[model samples]
Target: MSLARTFVGFSSTDINYYRLMTAWKANTNIDFDFVDCQLQNSINSENEVYIKKLCRERIGMASKFIQLIGQDTRHKYKYVRWEAEVAIEKGCTIIGVNLNAARKMEQDTCPPILRDIGAIFIPFSPYIIKYAIENYSMGPEDWYYYGNEIYKGLGYE
Candidate 1:
């Protein structure tokens, strides 16, 4: 199956990071959209209800969530944790990509929840992504339909 929908979360500061996902889409010819949860001004003014509503307003909903687990994420943003939890609660498949060593030779790091959630670990590299996408047989159609059902149940409409 072809890889279709995916939820991408990263520090809004991480611009280059967004490009990596785009590159994957280009190479694989897959329809992948990145969900930007970057709190630009402040979440203080952002009401809880709106935040929850915006949380579910994805530009393109994907069946899989490629969470970029980094040290900065846990510190810089709390919403990352919330979004991941929401996705998991909704039963979306989460794929943990270790980009530490993928970019740097340094030891790779990942969020603790990844281990607890039993997320599949993939080396942060284009080669590994290609392999995983090919080996996994999930298309965007299945992802979109299933994700839509889950979101609608949660009042995404």
Candidate 2:
């Protein structure tokens, strides 16, 4: 059987993604990577090409794109928008998160723009995220997961 793909995006300010990611890593092995929104400033034009190329590489390899549907991820950052878009354009199935369960403050998941872009919103609780990561090849989670590994990937620790 072929493996299912899921690319997760998030709001820059949503600290919850980190915490929840910790829970997810503890629970399962998702074999995931992340794109950093805050560090795009230092990237030069040469790096930009490499980045976009990487986006293509990632989307090309992926079977689904998981959007975290954070407050600003879709609008504030250009790279993320491009990543999601390229992922979609590359025929990677798009999976949007149901923010109702992951976040507690504001309501709803999958922003209007994401909806306009044609992403499928999957209702996901923490437990569900864990389960999905484990069994994604079987059925496909194609949605949200908290990711603490981001900081580590960025050399934060």
Candidate 3:
């Protein structure tokens, strides 16, 4: 099968995780064309508008939207939220991966908008991610959630 065209939504703090996923794509057959929107410096109003337009354009081209839900993600109310909102509006298959879920005892800390919309949340496992990208249906009833554990059609125990 061909790789899914994926747009990754994340904050600067999660750049390492983004890099790791990129490396996974290189080293393994988890085929995906990862797209990112990272700005190095602050921009004025005109530049900001252009960047937002560019981000929306790129996000609109994606088949899947993967959000790296770190603790600070919710606080990044500009780009991350805008990207996710655009993805949701464009009918992209949205998936939230909690970066701290593996070590943290609390529930997955996704953005409030995502959690409110009931977007599927999965662990940061490459196997599960690939499976989700390939198999997760874009229907409300297709997701499997057991209390704090959200399964994206991977049949996890």
Candidate 4:
């Protein structure tokens, strides 16, 4: 089977984790072709219009969006937030992965928009990641909202 097209949204400080994920993908059976949306080159002189256009286009092509939450992630909103907003608008399945070392004690520390939209937050586990990617439904109504909490329709606990 072909791998799912995934877009990874993260802070620049977490670049090493992204690199590790890439290496893991290369060495393991993770079934997703990851696209690193974090800008590496200097965009100092580039036009904002062009940058946004390029990012939106790349995110548009992805079927799944993974936001790696780190300590600095909640404070860095420029690229990560923009990428996630575009992904949500494009109907990509959003999965928030809490870095093992940076896991926050409060759920409210999660990106506000992601939490408001009821995105599933999971620990950094390869099996859970694969399961989330494979089982996430694309329809809007597939998400479950109960009382004050949003539960993933796939019965994640």
Candidate 5:
């Protein structure tokens, strides 16, 4: 099956979790896959304008945007917040993956730009993430999250 073209955003400190997601995509045994819209390499230049330009190019290619929510994600305004803003401006569906494994949006960890904005929040697990990418869509609400039953169906919990 074809993979969804997705742009994922996170704080630089959370790169390891992002790498794990890439590993999930690479593992044939896992049912997760996506055409990652992140920059193939970290931008070496310290120029903010050049960096944002490249990030915009990548985010533009995606129909979905996933934010990896970690402890300090809410405070990072440079790229992570700007990236989410760009994704929203481009009309991409937002999916928040809590690195803490919270199945719902944690107001403490979620970036303010993402709050009350009709984004689906899920745990950082391959099964639930794959299911969200394949089946979930934004609905009109303050925010969205799957119930315990949905998680149970995915063998979570």
Candidate 6:
């Protein structure tokens, strides 16, 4: 299958989790892969406009946006939330990966921009995430989450 062009949004505090995702893809044993479209390097300026301009360019290349929802994700207005906003504007399929391991969107942790938009939420597991990236499509529902039966089918308890 062709790799899905994906952009991931997350708070700076959760960078380690994002790194782990990269590790999952790098490991030959893991059944996870995607063409990541994140910025290659940090922009050398504090200018929000310049930063956002670079981010927008990257987001435009993605067909999917995976938001790593951490404790401060809702409060991170600087870039994390804005990235999701741009992804929505670009018509990317939104996938909210709960770092806290929630199968559904947690009202307390989800960012305002992703709440009403058509998106799917899943735990931070590589299997479920890969499954979403491969199988999910935006539909009429504002939010989507797989039932336990579906997770069980994916070998999740």
RMSD of each candidate relative to the true structure? 11.7, 9.7, 4.8, 5.6, 1.0, 1.0
**Cα lDDT, all candidates:** 0.51, 0.50, 0.70, 0.67, 0.92, 0.92
Compared with the true structure, what per-residue lDDT tens digits does model 4 show for residues 1-157?
Answer: 5567788888889877777777766765664344454444546655878878878877888888988888777777777788889999998888888886322223544677676464666666555566656666543432221221223433345
lDDT score, residue 153, model 4?
A: 38
Candidate 6 lDDT over residue span 1-157, tens digit each: 8999999999999999999999999999998999999888877999999999999999999999999999999999989988988999899999999999999989999997888677999999999999999999986758989999889998988
lDDT of 2 by residue, 1-157 (tens): 3334545555556547745754554554643333322222333566777867755665676666666666565454566677766766776555555555442112343444455443445434444443343343322333333344632443333
What does candidate 2 score on TM?
A: 0.54
Q: Evaluate residue 93 in candidate 6 and report its C-alpha lDDT on the 0 to 100 scale.
A: 96
Per-model TM-score, in order, reads 0.59, 0.54, 0.75, 0.73, 0.97, 0.96
Residue 108 local lDDT, model 3: 41
The lDDT of model 1 is 0.51
Q: After superposition, which runs of candidate 2 have C-alpha atoms over 4 Å from their true positions?
A: 1-3, 15-19, 28-46, 100-113, 116-118, 130-157
Candidate 3, 7-99: lDDT as tens digits: 888887998898888788777565443443333344556676797887887787788888888888888877889899998898888788878
| Model 4, residue 104: C-alpha shift (Å) | 9.6
Better of 1 and 2 by lDDT: 1
Q: How many clashing residue pairs, candidate 5?
A: 0
lDDT (Cα, 0-100) at 44 in candidate 3: 54
Worst 10 residues of 2 by lDDT: 33-42
Using lDDT as the measure, which candidate wins?
6
Model 1 / residue 67 / CA error / Å: 0.6
- Candidate 5 lDDT over residue span 1-157, tens digit each: 6777899999999999999999999999998888899999988999999999999999999989999999999999989999999999998889999999898989899998888888999989999998888887778758999998988898776
